[model samples]
Structure formats: structure tokens, C-alpha cells
Target: MDDRPNPIDRNLLGIYLNDHLAGATLGVDRARTLADAESERDPALADAVRPIAEEIAEDRAELLKIMRRLEVPVRRYKIVAGRLAERAGRLKANGRLVSRSPLSPMLELELLRLGVEGKAAGWRTLRRLADADTRLDPGQLDNLLERAHRQLDTLEQLRLRQVSTTFQESGDRPVHQESHA
Candidate 1:
């Protein structure tokens, strides 16, 4: 009996992979930018994010490799749009006009977290295909999934820390008011 699964629709698979490639491009750019910007102000954060940024870049390469194995041609326009979108994200108001706002890191971290989560889902999707597709590596996808989980944890911790500092003065706590009749 044949063990190979039925072939997937190459056209649809190509489109899906290309869209993820665009997202990966934006994610790599944003991760590097966040790491560099945090270096001066938050060395610890820079240290934590730097590795994740490198990993994200590596993950992007891996995605490209997978696309090549699947014979999916990258859509250049999508890559360009991803680049432009990343730049445009910088224009959002962050409660500061000139200098970097404390809110900026918070927002960036949240975005990065969301991207990683999406990437994780992509990895899982490929892993599912790996069961019948010899070209897809389930073990590699598992490793990628684990790394994404770690990155999510780190980003969440950093984001929570930023929330405390950005929303409250050093020693201040939220005050409660009693209801009046």
C-alpha cells in the first residue's frame, strides 16, 4: 500500500507561504530595530531581545528554505509591502513627540509577541503536513515551536515590566476610591 498522502494544491500553498514570508520579513526588521533601540536605554532588554532577533532572522531563512523545497516562488511585491508597513508602524503616536516614548517599547513588544504567536501557528501547520509530506520536517518544526514559546514568555515578561513603569511612577500604586451616596 502507498504511504504518501495526496498532493496539496500548490497554488494555494504558494500564496499562504508567501503571505507568511511577508510577515516574517516585517518581524525580522521589527525585532532587530527593537533590540537596537533598547540597547542604550535597557541593556538587559537588549540582551534578551538580541538573541530572539537573531533567532527570528534564522527562522525566516528556514521558512525560505521550506518554500524552496515546496517550489513556491516569493512574491517580491509582498516583501516590499512588508518593509513599508514596518516603517509606517513607527509613525504611531506614543505619547512623545521627539524622544522615544516609554509606550513605544510596550507596543513594539506586544506586536512582536503577536508575530511570534502567528509564527508558532505556522510551524504547527507545517508540522501537521509533515506527517505525509517527506519534504516537511516535523522535528525541526517542533524545535521552532518550542523556541517560539520561549520567545513569547520572554516578550510577555518584558511587556509586563514596561507596563508597570510606563503606567505608574516608581513608587506609586493604583489608588482606590470609596463610593459616595
Candidate 2:
């Protein structure tokens, strides 16, 4: 039996993989930036985020390996555009001009969490394809999917932690809340 994907299927797969690759690139860049920026001011957040950033980069590398296995050509322009978009995202106002806003960390964590969710979806899609595609390893996809789930859980914990840091006062009351009790 011929194990190769048909030409049309291969072409479509190439496009899909490249799109996800672009997103992965952006995710890696954003995760790294967030980790580095948080290092000094929020050492605990930095500690929590640094490993996730590393895993994100590793996941991007894994995607590249998967694309190579599937014979999908990397779209260099898409990668470049993804990087540029990540940089552009930094320009959005977080209610501060020069100094880093308290909201920045929380918002960045939320964005990273969303990216991981997308990545997990991609892993699931590939896992589904693995049943028919010999070039795709089900074991590898399973591992990647599991790691993505773990990353999602970690990001959520970090993001929720950021909520109080960003919005609450030293007394544990929300910044905007008035005394009622």
C-alpha cells in the first residue's frame, strides 16, 4: 500500500501546518518577552513563566520537526509576519505610557494562555490525522498533547494569580471595591 498522502491532501496539509507554525512562532516570542520582562519586578511570576516559555520554544521546534516529516515547506514570510505582529502587540496601551502597568502581566498571561489553547487544538488535530498518516507519530502527538494540557494548566494558575496582583490592594480587597462590611 502506498503510504504517501495524495498531492491535494499534502498541499492542504502544508498550508494548515504553516499557519499553525506561524502562530507557534508568535507564541514563542511573546512567551519569552513576558518571562524576561517579569524577571526582576515579579520574581515569582518569572520563575513560573520561564519554564513555560522554554516549553513553548520546544513545542515550536517540535512543530518544525513535524513539518519536515510531512514534507511541508516552512513559509518564511509567515514567520516574519508572526514576529512582527507580536512586536506590534506591545504597543497597545495598558493605561501607562512609560512604566509597565500592573495590568500588563495579567493581560500577557491571558494571551499566552489563549495561544496554548490553540496549540492544544492543533496537537489534537494532528493526533487525529496520525491514525491514517504513517509519517505522523501517534506517540509523539500524544506526548505533545499532554504537555500542552499541562502548559494550559500552569498558565491558568499563573493568570489567576496575576488577577489579584493586578487588581487587588495590599489588604486583599479589589482596588475598586468600597468597604461594605
Candidate 3:
């Protein structure tokens, strides 16, 4: 039996980079679409969501830049897969025929919250690697981490408002129900 040192797993890094890149792309698309829908629904909400959409785009660009700096190739197939997944998400049986359901916004806000959480974890991982990889900057990662936290705060506020609006009592109780009064 011959024992030899194992080759470096270069594909692992490429896969990791591609996965995050795809995720960022998906996040950007979802953010833009949701921003447009919400803004159209209530013009006043535009003020709250417009900047978030812009920031998401900027973050996606940053991820691409990072991939470039690391010489990691962005997999086109992954981007396509991400787009398809986003499209499939809309097909879920939400009990609505054509019009948007009240639950849609709540589900979307939850997705955004989860995406932000994932982004924060990615930033933290990159920050850990910054000490070893000169291409990565700790400062930039720190800024991104902070921004993700702020994004979560904003998303949480929006989610809470949506929850209140979507699931609140309609004050139409059944005839069998006794009035507290």
C-alpha cells in the first residue's frame, strides 16, 4: 500500500463561492420584486423599502467583486438555478387564485429575514478567513456584518407590521361565541 498526501480540494472553495453568489443573486431579485410590489401597494412604503432594495443590489455586486478578487469563477448555471428556484417559490399553493394573498407578504418577510441571517453568517465566516486571505478585508466584512444586522432590524419591523395586519382579528365572531361585554 502506498500512502500519499491528498491534493488540495480546490473545488470546495469554488462551490462555496458559487453557492453564496447564487444566493446573493436570488436575494437581489427577490428584494427588487418585493420592493416594487410593496411600493405599488402602498406608495408610502416606498420610502422604507427602496433603500433596502438598493443595498441588496450593492451587496450582490460586492459578492461578485469578492469572487473576482479570489479568482473564483461565477457559475452561470447556479445563477439560472437560483432564478428558477425563485420562480418556483411563487407557485406554492397559497390558497389564492389570482390576487395576492394576505399571507404572501408575511411569508416574503420571513424569507427576507432568513436571507439576511444567512448573509450575516457568510460575512462572519469571511471575516474569520480575512486574517489568512489577503484578498479579504476584515474591515469590509465587519461593515457588511453590521449592515446585515441593520437589515434584520428593518425586516423585523416590517414583518411585525405585516403580522399585525395579516393575522389580526376581523371582529367577526361566530354567533355561538359570547361577547366579552
Candidate 4:
């Protein structure tokens, strides 16, 4: 509505020229002035701004790629924690007597709280319990804790598998489907 290019618009064009010219051809000040003048005279002249915009967009894509690469391990950690919390909640509710494996309501609640807090050690303890073959005594809450931990580990593994597949697909195709058969 102002019919004038703002600092942000000038900055965007400046960034584009900087990238397209490899920072050698266009002076930032000159590009900014040009963008400002063009914007004031005719907003339609903004079409002349595309090359710079494209370059800036390419740079942004590269930065995002780097960010996601760094986030992979952190994402895995969150998924593991989330899974542990979910299993703990299930145990606390109706899963106590339903599971053949040991799972204590009290311990499950505690582990759930720990998982929500992002504690990896809590999930590890549950995993160890789940691996053991002996059936836990119904009276012992520790067994429930162990089973919950193990389930959490399994859930994390499953999440990783799904994520890996998604990464492999890379948005070129759909990753999930409803099975009618």
C-alpha cells in the first residue's frame, strides 16, 4: 500500500545479486538502491527481481539441508523419549494385568514422567526388563517398569525405521497408504 520498497525487499534483492554474481559483480549498496528505486517507480518492476530471489532461495534450501542433517540424531532422541512416555502411560492405565510380561503401574508412571522429561536412562532401564524371559511376579511393580522400558525401545526402533523410509523417499513419492486388501 505504501508503494515503496521496504528494507526487507531491498535486502532480499541484495542477497540474490550477491549470490548470482558470486559477491563480485554487484555492490550491495548499489543493488539496494536499485531495488528501492524500482519499487517506488512501479511495483510491477519487481519481476526484474526474480534472478536474485532465485539465488537467495537456493541458498536457503542448502541451509535447510544442513540444519536437517544436524537434527537427525536429536529427532531420534525425541522419538525414543516419546515412545517411552506413551508405553508408561499405557501401563499405568489398563495394561498392568493385561500384559503377560511384568509391568508395574507405579513404576510405569514414574518412568512415564522421566521419559516426558527426556531422560534416556529411564528408557534404558525399561528396555533391560523387557528382554528378560522370566515372568515377573504380579505383585512386583519392577517387572512392569522393565516391560514398559522394553516397549519404549521397540517403539523407538519402529519410529527410526519409518523416518528412514521417509528420508529415502525424499518427498518424491507418498510414504504411507491405506490397505484395502
Q: After superposition, how far is residue 1 of candidate 1 from its true place, in Å?
A: 13
Model 4 Cα lDDT, one tens digit per residue, 106-159: 232233223322323323332343334122222232543454355345434433
For all candidates, the clash counts are 0, 0, 0, 7
lDDT of each: 0.87, 0.88, 0.77, 0.34
- Best to worst by lDDT, what's the order? 2, 1, 3, 4
Q: Tell me which of candidates 1 and 3 scores higher on TM-score.
A: 1
Q: Give RMSD (Å) of candidate 3 vs. truth.
A: 7.9
Candidate 1: C-alpha lDDT: 0.87
Candidate 1 residue-wise lDDT, 1-181, digit = tens: 9877877888988888888889999999999999888777777778888898999999999999999998889999999998999999988888778877767778899999999999999998889888767898888899999999999998999898878766776358433333465
Positional deviation of 82 in candidate 4, in angstroms? 15
- Cα deviation in Å at residue 76, candidate 3? 0.7
Ranking of models by TM-score: 2, 1, 3, 4
lDDT of 3 by residue, 133-172 (tens): 7788888889999999999999899888777677856464
Where does candidate 2 have its weakest 10-residue lDDT segment? Answer: 170-179
TM-score, candidate number 3: 0.85
Worst 10 residues of 3 by lDDT: 170-179
- Per-residue alpha-carbon lDDT of model 2 for 79-116, expressed as tens digits? 99999999999999888899778888899999999999
* Model 4 misplaced stretches (Cα beyond 4 Å): 1-139, 169-181
